[model samples]
Target: MTAWTMSDTGRSAAGGLPAGETAAQLVHRRLRDDIVSMRRRPGDVIFEKEIALEARVSRTPVREALLRLADEKLIEIVPKSGTMVARIPAEILPEIIVARAALEAVTVRAAAESARGSDIAGLRAIIERQRETLATGDIDGFHATDEVMHRAIAEAGRLPGLWSMIVQIKVQLDRYRRLTLPQPHRMERALAEHEAIIDAIAGRDAETAAAAMDRHLDGLRVSLAPIRDLNPDYFSGDVGAVYDRWAGEMA
Candidate 1:
């Protein structure tokens, strides 16, 4: 696991905030991105002293940022044990996916009915950029573009606020998606699904577009199984039982 630090270039890759961004905001964005991208894996301790040193700021700002992240449930601050990245709770995943699918399905259907030719072209351009990112094996870049593409659909539907809601709901799902990104051909398959959804929307077929979105989200549910199997420690919920069984077997 590579340690993520603020760049010497004075610009961090938390999607490149404006010049006036505060140190606390910068710290929050960098750490949040690292957590979501799995660069800071679940259960990994987050030391305020180290982060403050790396960011060239005092521990006060770092502590403030960590408190914000804790509110988002991205990191847990134990009373005496310190802070660690929060594990994905296995039980809530289905609920998150279901909520996303419902909202996104409604969004895509609206996009199909209301999107202009320019909107369709813009989406196609995003897909092309995703291809370029895939060719270069930039998973992080691909993920960024993936987010842009979905947000574009919401904007096309004239429901830009829905994108914000989706963003909040998908935080956990984003972590799980990052976990699955290294699997063979996952990005390629996701691109194909995106193309299908775009085609349906471009054709002005609301039913098809909604169904395509649902199917795409369904694939996310399927992807979780293998990731859980590979990284049993990165998830919560049944982990205690699993550990207990392992201990019994060893005994």
Candidate 2:
């Protein structure tokens, strides 16, 4: 398990915050990012006091932030055992892939119809940066760019609100994606898929763009088995049962 620590600089990982952002909101954002990025790994315990000390805030805010994370299913707060980052359960991957594929396919189709030349240029610029990150072996940078690329598609499609909803649901999927980042040829394959999607959109072929998005998302499903094999302890074999037990205990 990885240890959690606050930066001495006191800046949020999500960058500059708007005015009047509460301590709980800052803590929640930082912790959520850390958990998704695997800086705080599955099953790692989180102490409110330690987090409070690091964030230079009261335990009240830490507790409030944790409850918010719990609502997102990003972390589990056990009655006696305290809080821990939630494991990336294998059972939910298929569902998440399906949902994301449906939403993103629609998004790309819309983008093919609505995206301006500048939007396409911006996406290509991001891909270029992604290529640079791959060459430099900056896995984190590549992943960050990957997210921006997808969000750019949503923005181009005039679905920024839908993108927010996708962000909420893709937290676990993001973790799974992170797990596959270091795999052999994975980044290259993803880059190729992204290019295909971009090409279809640039050509204003809505059908092709949707097809490409579906194919790209389906690739995520293909990687799940290999990921489970690689990190057996990181997923629940019986996810429903586990969730039921957690809900019962919480109730």
Candidate 3:
């Protein structure tokens, strides 16, 4: 058995669960992160034997981890064929974008209205880091910074639930964004959008901040439109099939 100990985050040491639970939470987080970050992109086949051998755990725990991932929509558990990373629908893109736009707009507006000097300082610090990443042409770092910046805004807004929703949608949006990351001037344009958002918030102009966020989201959709049109296969078709399966329950 793997030695159990508390992780840095104070999670249940190695396994992060009861000694008799038979599954390691750390292993689950690792596997979940891999799929959510698109390291395991949509439609990639996942073999239980392979995962079990790699995690050094039994297939039972690996299966447990996979079930958790499927529940999060990061991976799909196909009947008999095995679990694969989910290929979400293109429609989910716009839906997520819309949700992000609304929530982020509200977040920024709230941040502007209620932010303390320290909150503003923290946001500025994050933006400066984002600027440095862009200057260094660190594409992955920029993505990381971008994720942090938005989360900061949501946090400053004091709406943790809304922030959680953003986290969920971001997993899907990020895959599309990565496809457009190589486009010429994309980073510069993204920087400009971030600057506009920050400036409006700093100026304490809620309307301007909300409008700026909407524009940013609209631009994201525009940039991805061509790529989305070109690559229809990037998302999973299983989403619809799953929907059909659950439609009766939903109805």
Task: Estimate the lDDT of model 1.
Answer: 0.86
- Candidate order by TM-score, decreasing, is 1, 2, 3
Put down candidate 1 lDDT per residue, 1-251, tens digits, no spaces: 34444454165566354498877887898899889988899999988999887777778879999999999989999999999999988767777887898899888999999999999999999999999999999999999999999999998898898889999999988999998878999999899999999999999999999998888888777676677889998998884554444335434
- Candidate 3 wrongly placed segments (more than 4 Å): 1-24, 236-251
Model 3 Cα lDDT, one tens digit per residue, 10-73: 3453544544444556457767666655567677888888876665567887878888777777
lDDT per residue (tens digit) for residues 9-100 in model 2: 25577644435778888789789889899888888889899988777778998999999999888899999888998888766766677678
How far is 16's C-alpha from truth in model 3 (Å)? 8.1
Q: Residue 85 CA error for candidate 2 (Å)? A: 1.1
In order of lDDT, best first, we have 1, 2, 3
lDDT of 3: 0.74
lDDT of 3 at 39: 67
Preferred candidate (TM-score higher): 1 or 2:
1
TM-score for each of the candidates: 0.88, 0.87, 0.79
Badly placed stretches (over 4 Å) of model 1 are 1-20, 239-251
